[model samples]
Target: MRRHILPPVTRPILLLFALAALAGCGPTAEPAKAAADEHGAAVDEFERGPHRGRLLRSGDFSVEVSIFEEGVPPEFHVYAYRKDKPVNPRELTLTMELTRLDGRVDRFSFAPQGEFLRGAGEVREPHSFDVKVRALEGGRAHQWAYAAYEGRTTITSEAARAGGVTVETAGSIVMAELVDMAGRIEITPEGQADVRAWYPGRVMALNAELGQTVRKGQVLARVESSHSLQTYSIPAPLSGVVIAKNSNVGDVAGGEALFVIADPTKLHAEFFVYPRDAERVRAGQRVEVRTLSGDNRVVAPVEAIVPTADIASQTLMAHVHLPPGASATFRPGMGVEGSFQVAAWPTALAVRTKALQRFRDFTVVFARVGNTYEVRMLELGRQTPEWTEVLGGLEPGTQYVTDGAFLIRADIEKSGASHDH
Candidate 1:
């Protein structure tokens, strides 16, 4: 070989150009190196095909697999190319096998559709799977397998604990089916009394104030009898709290009520049962009474169901007797709510309401298997305020995520490892 010498200035320029060409080749060689992996099974995480899908390569052939979910169920779309040239999709048959993180294996076959192939059936969601593709061309089989996961991630036990994630085991529970109704606290008729003027008189002095406790025959006021003009004492008719005081000092008293008293400890909850649930409201049934704010709850048995229904509301009245100590938290005329238990059943599998989540089209619970949380679908039955009866889809003693499941879901979505597969 003959050596030709160039000027020093030209030599530097040629060297710079050579270096630039090599740097350009660096990027293009990356995809070639990835394609040269064992069986051409390499996943370019940052690269996607024109259809925004995973690109799998085997020898001279490349296939782009995408999920098209526009106005239809999710199905696979596969586009084929041979050595950077668009290959006729009709000359090839493609099939795919997906093994999910939960150990579920799904096989899909593609059929020729216009310029590409479409997979049969709808692809499931949370698209995390190990993918394998086989393409039959000219009586020869070319295959590639790679792990392609979207919207899936694993968190360590320490991280989970730091994030407040908690778990509980699924088990059996006794659930009560209840009929909810509106109610109010009322003083029973026998528990209330009205203080009246024994004789026509003039009130001379008033002692009892509104809401004051008075004993039976306690002097509430002194009055002067109009007949004899003699000042006499007026007394409370019962030992109860004074709810109303209508008389004032030095006022003339007639046959009208001077004071209203009620025994707060002898109160009852009166619930109105709508026509739809009136038949289920029966005496002796178990009832749970709660304030509208849900701060207080009292379990009492139904004392009676009134025979007549309210004409305007068409609701039957059910009364529950309150214990004497109920006066501490409840008062007459206070609005309340009550639930009457009409049926009860034993469930073999149950979980807390917080453990349930809506993912895709299924109600799912996250089951902790080792360090991995697997999504478990649920078939639910009757539900209560705290527990939900599980009819199927969960086994007893299975530990599931309860408190911080949404956080795990957020992590999975952030990882972009789950999608409709």
Candidate 2:
């Protein structure tokens, strides 16, 4: 029995080993490695493919791009021709398309020209035109549209890509906005208020502290007639608060104020204006007064503009009327500082104060188009304390930097930080 059991167990074990060995020798493959290799080939082909662009239509004018190698800007320059005569100045339009990775396409167009090119010479002169572009992030097809002025008629057309460019530099590039240039005026006063003894009276009943409200004709203190010749009651002429008391109870009549009363509503400010600005400081111009005490800004109308200027100071004094609402809370001696709305260009373009930048030579501002920032040259006009008048280079509806403008300027000054306009 032991011999038969041993043979059966040994034979079964031998058969199992033989089957496993045969299975191990069967077919096997590196599937993952093969897949990876195929993906690499696909990527290479995508990167090496050609990008094609064509000028679908062009005005009698043409533009050449030289600054940016491929994706960079400062690229397009335009030239005009009249007939075949090379008109001293020609008007033009164009269209262009960009084809990017993954078969994506982009298109762009140019704004109409308002002015003819000055001093146009024959033989294709060099000029730059700023066109609006739509980005095709990763595609091969894009379209451009432009307009050309050829005397009577305008020409519109599309341009295609001549080549594709790849950038080797690696880093981050972002477009940022910048502040406009501005001017500010700071002044120190040289005039003082005149203080005099108001009246000499007898002490009456006391009714107020240093800052207490007293109505006009209100009896602050009553005095029994010390002089029989003057047997009339004395009353306050102005409604104000008592600031000082010279005499106490039961004192003899002295020629001093028993209670000092001042009218807070009668506050006045004298602002000096240059002779050039004097013409604008008429009797009815609007004025704005600003004080550092909270947000207590006062807007008032000009009451009068004194024609005579202080000869020594070479400045004219302009007196503005404050509103009763403002005068109620204001004190006479409180200092007020701000600008006068002398001459207003009602149709002028303006931006907020915080939008300006103080540059060494000329003021600079960034014009925002979609997500891109464009450098702008500005000619500034008369400026109010809160807003600056834009003389040139910017459109009215454009959004500009109001706060954190310096940060935008810093970003722009950095190399490769701004997009070409």
Candidate 3:
């Protein structure tokens, strides 16, 4: 009975004390909770200065950009701004680009730069954006967005370009190549029936006309001399079409050709070369001839190049041998072009004809630097339809555009870029 009576006062006092302690704890936590809620809240505010990046001339041929943040992470976000213009989603290629910069390099890629190179084109951008900086080291991250001044952030890269012809090269170069040449059939200088007339002084008559067909030893006309009254008919020297006939029946005959018939079976090409090219010319050299008729390219071997040059033309004549029974399409006096292999250069650096751009005295090419194109001046030597021998100005292992050189030039010109081409 005594314990029960004393516990009553203590129990009531303990309950009151507990209630007061709980009330104090509730208010104390309110300030801390309010601070935490405000700490991570989204804010609407503005900042001054160039907190964003704007890409300028991307080196000589492309565009690159950098933000004002030190120790930027590998996975930083990039925002593009274009003075309120919407961005082009198709042109963006961050996923396809090949990253080459080492970890130490501040440069980073955000688009698929390689796919654009599949065609002949180029890319130029002006936009502003916001991005998140993903920390790769410890997974720490931060986010930011910039309005980017009226014109901020630009990226330039190379794209595939279409090919175009160089008009100036047409007239300066041989319009076409000639591969074969042959002489017309020949006959006696006079219309003589005599089986044998070896002397230079012989008068002859003729009955054949230009383009007339004649047979070997067939009497075409008669030959008469002042000493004798024997009239002999001039026979066809060989079976061929008469290409040229200088005399007709009853005409006074001189040692000059009365009828020139070429042996169709025996054909050869004769080309004239300048004195400089004649030095490199030799008998038995391989040559390619392009006939003016129907783009004919005939390959033949050089037979002879006379040591003498034509006094009037100042040209060295070279005879080229052809295959027997050639197509009749090739005729005498047809213009043809020829090519000769001068020498070989082992390990010679070369590129396709389309890869070159002709300047005043030098040649230029677009050299790939990273994802951009750089103008490279090249020293050129011998050239062919398919390739050009590079004497200098390009590396052996580098890749270059072969088919779309003109498109690249067009892009550079359109952009008002400084280039040698």
Candidate 4:
């Protein structure tokens, strides 16, 4: 405002001050610094430190951490390097805190080995955890924290519901160790009959058709004796369905079967047990008979173990007697599946077979605690078609995902939350 012209030195100083004021009014420097602070230690994805482990650097010294499991328990090995040169193993004391996905934390101390430091305790699978490594260097501690992801994931309850995930609790179950075998629906000896021609016949009139229901003593056909030329009646021996018609009208009938009848309601299941299973199977054992459709199942007790074995298949026969009301849906000669309960025991912990998922090299089931799902490694025992006994790794009363577990696995895999080293 003073119409007076300033000196060159004063003008340059004023211009400098104006530029500084504009710079101060611009974006604050705090955001950039905050971002840098938030991402504390950077992960060198492309560069692995010595010992082929993850490298964490402080000043010119770097610590390489890896899990080594050769001829020893799984343990962490830490190697210290300075400017690509090996640092004295005695110079650093390493400790690690592994926080697992199940909210459990395991702490490990490392002592100096020949050339590096090794963790004192074992590291349990599946190796997915939030790992914090602290090295005591020159009486001062340097820390690095990162996540070692394995088979793990987290999903909200609403999301799981929308994804069709269902949960079931792990609990005690009586699982029968079953032996699978091929079987067929057969007619009991008393329930089957072969209607024969009473005399040699030159001509006959057939009255029964295949699959026809007939009453006991019902005339199935009329046969004429060749010697006397007299007609005789061929009656059904049992009240049941005619399964086989051996004679046609005007055909010669000898002393052979004219009709075969079987009572469907008196069916039995006959299973062929191989030598491997024959010793375990015995009379009075429980057997479940299922049709090829798999929708029908009948529980019956084993009636007998036939002494004869099949010459070609080398399998022994086991007979299961179906009760009168139990064979309504079964018919003779129908192919069936027999699951013999060879062994049975009460398990303290068991889960649905559908709940199991293969994660890494171990079998895992997703257990739901609150809104989060954590992977549970399973040590399996006897397994049935519907249930699997859990020998260890899962506790009773733990709620596990039974359906859509693979969907959760897919979600975790898609999120890239997987274990790497």
Candidate 5:
């Protein structure tokens, strides 16, 4: 994915990546203290504390809170100050509530740890949420609430469709395990013809030239039998191009091959399979053949597998006969690539690998509910280049972004939302 964070002035912000960007927490809000609280709100520039955490200030009393997650599960760390001087952490009773996008609230209580107060519960990943803080100092109570958002953005459905944003339902998919090999196109044995005279004779008149296209029974040469002293016409054996000419006029034609004809339309691709993979390759298996540049492609079944291995390379050859229609682009001796489907594994739930995006420390995809989308952190299992098994996190039939997901992420980032504490 392109990391180039496009500037918002260009209207680069798109809602397609709606949920995949929810890793940051931003802004303070809701003046009345919420008994229970959660794009996301924007703050000009959050005030920072000496510890580099978001600062919650109110006159002579303030609390600077940070998520301490260096080598342990994320936990909240808070430092309190009174009249611009350090205050005893033990003298204050601190508590907080984090309201997530789905209306789930996680509550925490704090205990003093040296100079900082450590919260009891883990903050969890993708710190994006709305947080409320309540601190009891002597006879006074200070309450603060704010909204934090990252990796979350929204745009109208019409705009999303116009921008070419596409989505797909996450469901069961059979993963194809492919064995890729390199080979070259070749003329099948039945497609080639080695011409010879019917009897011992001398080439009286060799008519066919190298590369001449000839049809079956077309007279290619006239030979004079050594014994009969009579001329006999040697017609073509097949309809194809004359690729090799062993004898011409006035040359002996009986003892050697007169010509070699090859039909380009009857061709096959031969792929070398090493011993480890040779056992898995069998006749009747489908194989995808493509030119080295991948401009042309064809799917054909394996027609044969050589019983013998190459003496030098110790590799068996798998032959896939190309269809007659592929002759236009598939030529003998042209290097090609073969992707043989060797095995397959089915999983109940899976998502397009391309749809997955980076969200903080987890792999996530945006889930859509009506016109809105949000992130779902996934627990991945087996994987293939095209699809990945979803063991946990995403639900069956959830809609996910397939194409233009990065554009969404770029738009959200352009909003200056930071999920990092």
Candidate 6:
């Protein structure tokens, strides 16, 4: 159903337009012919009533079809006249049907309202459809059929693919408030271990070397006690890769660590928060962490916020834990980027942000039904890079063009189609 007020929008016009904007864009259908009458003759007359509505005639019975959409959803107002004389709305029975591209039919029956007949249902958007009207008056039957289109274009399957046209369904989404910050990957102090000999002595044999992976309690080195002249085995304190080795074979191990082991998997990303974002950023908020090259990404909550500012940059820091399995790709000291979710809002109706485009004075998206794509004007609310809240002008479950929408708009403009009564 119609959601907001719009101007005269439905007009049957050119269908076939150039796909010249892209290379190898396949064949398109030919331009459509004019709307035909009940006798199958091309209707070529252009008649407008005093209300600026379309005028159709069958003998002495004529009806003016107009849409009233000032401050409400679109509704049809039919003014009946017999030989230029106003006919009481009660004297006629009128019904209209609109067949849309997707094979859905909308029927509206007219009832007496003031001096004219008002439709029982709303006239929805895009307004591109085949219209049929039947009127009964004074024991006579009158029929008129025509095509009305606005913001519509047709394309074949191959053309759509070659033009990079993509479609996605519109639905509910949660809008996030993001704060971008520069960051780096690091290993926490708990991830590192220092191995030391129990007694001051000369290292007789070194079992573990730098850059070697070792298990907890694994023999790291053997040392001889200088005090008692007894030999002892030095073991690794934690299971990790040996990052540092000080005392080696034949070297004196006197009050010094011999090996340093660090768990590469225990990592966190530190993001620098500026003064402006200090109030909004806090621990426990969700953060989107990505590598410098943007090839890898992960979502995790902020592990904690450093209470003190960096001595060099004077910026606050937010730490987000990296997945344990991510150590193979993300490493210590590697530069990264993190987007902190400072706030969020949930919405029931939303569309892809990438699908939105400018149409006239409105922001619109191309809605798809079979091979036809038409513009859907939107009233917007909160917006993010991913989705935007749809305040009006769209229905749930509608498929919309998310990519190559520019191609559709270009064709409609090149074919000279516009909002027309």
**lDDT for each candidate structure:** 0.74, 0.39, 0.43, 0.74, 0.78, 0.79
Best by lDDT: 6
Mind giving the per-residue lDDT tens digits that candidate 2 earns over 1-421? Answer: 0111111110011000000111111122111111212212111111010111111112222222222224532233232322323322223343333332112344434333332221121111111122222212122222233211000110111100111101111112221121111111111121111112233444545555666777776655555565443433556666766666666666755555666666555555556777666555577666667553435667666666678878897777777666556665554655666456555545347666446774334465554433333344567766655566677755566655454445444433432221211
Candidate 5 on 204-293: residue-level lDDT in tens? 898889989999999988999988999999888889999999986788766578999999999999999999998898898889899988
Ordered list by lDDT, greatest first: 6, 5, 4, 1, 3, 2
TM-score of each: 0.57, 0.47, 0.42, 0.57, 0.65, 0.80
For candidate 6, the 10 contiguous residues with the lowest summed lDDT are: 17-26
TM-score, candidate 1, is 0.57
**1 versus 2: better TM-score goes to:** 1
What TM-score quantifies how close candidate 2 is to the native fold? 0.47
Tell me the deviation in Å of residue 113 in model 5: 24
- Candidate that beats the other on lDDT, 2 or 5, i.e. the better one: 5
> Candidate 3: where is the Cα deviation over 4 Å?
1-135, 139-209, 217-235, 244-259, 264-267, 290-297, 309-315, 322-330, 334-337, 346-349, 357-386, 389-404, 411-421
Predict model 6's lDDT versus the native.
0.79
Model 6: residues with Cα > 4 Å off, grouped in runs:
1-52, 68-93, 102-122, 254-256
What are the clash counts of all predictions, listed in order?
A: 8, 48, 43, 3, 10, 0
lDDT of 6 by residue, 1-421 (tens): 1122222222233452111111111122112336654433333334667787766667667788888888987899999988868899999999999887667899999999998999998888766677777888887777777666767777775667767788998888788889889999999778888888899998999998789999988998999999999999988877899999988699989877898899999999989888889999988999999897788988888989888987887889888987898898889999998889999988989988878998877799998887778889899999887779999988888999987777778766655445554
Model 2: how far residue 412 lies from native, Å: 3.7
TM-score-wise, the better of 3 and 5 is 5
- lDDT for model 2, please: 0.39
Per-residue accuracy of model 3 over 1-421 as CA lDDT, tens digit each: 0111111110010000000111111122101111111322212122111323222111111112233223631232333223323233234432212121111112234542331212112211111122212111112122222221111111133123112211111112222222233232212222222223333224465566777778887776666754565665667766777777666555566666777776655666777777767677778877776665436666777877878888997887788776654446455556666676544344357766656875324477665534344455677766766567676766665556554455555544433332100
Q: What does the lDDT come to for candidate 3?
A: 0.43
Cα lDDT for residue 138, candidate 1: 70
What's the CA RMSD for each of the models?
Answer: 15.6, 23.3, 25.6, 16.5, 8.4, 9.0
